[model samples]
Target: MYAIVNIAGQQFKIEQGQEIFVHRLDGEEGAAVEFDQVLLVDQDGKVNVGTPVVEGAKVNGKILAHVRGDKVKVFKKKRRKGYQKETGHRQDLSKILIEKITF
Candidate 1:
């Protein structure tokens, strides 16, 4: 079975034993997390879609680790005016393993 769930303001299609990276979540490494915002689920070709979210549906996962994404560099320059700016950023992320999906 597979499910489309909302986590940290993003939607993800997940299945059992699948690992995914998402925006950082609270709790420690190896922590168990439950996502209740399941938008849809497919069970052997039969599908269940939610009106916003499926009631009583949940996606269970384990937080494997916390990590940071690669840095993104931003540079700006103005010709003749001799103006320049540079900045970089890295996004905090969490790796999670999907354990189960139940409804």
Candidate 2:
């Protein structure tokens, strides 16, 4: 079975044994986390949706590792103003392995 869940202000469709990268979480490797904001679930072609979230529905996941995304370069220039700016950024991320989804 699979379900749509909310994680770090984002929605994701996930299934058991699946791995996904989400916004950074305050957990160490091998730590466990629970996502209680399950929006919908599909099993055997049957779909269950909630008003906001499904009551008594949850998704269990294990923290695999903490990671960083590739650097992004931002450059700005104003022609004839002799002004230029450059910046770079990298987003912190976390890897989680879905263990189960129960409703």
Candidate lDDT scores, in order, read 0.96, 0.96
RMSD (CA, Å), each prediction: 0.8, 0.8
| Residue lDDT tens for model 1, 1-103 | 9999999999999999999999999999999999999999999999999998999999899999999999999999999999999999999999999999999
Error of 2 at 48 (Å): 0.4
- Give the alpha carbon lDDT tens digit for every residue of 12-59 in model 2: 999999999999999899999999999999988999998999899999
Candidate 2 runs further than 4 Å off: none
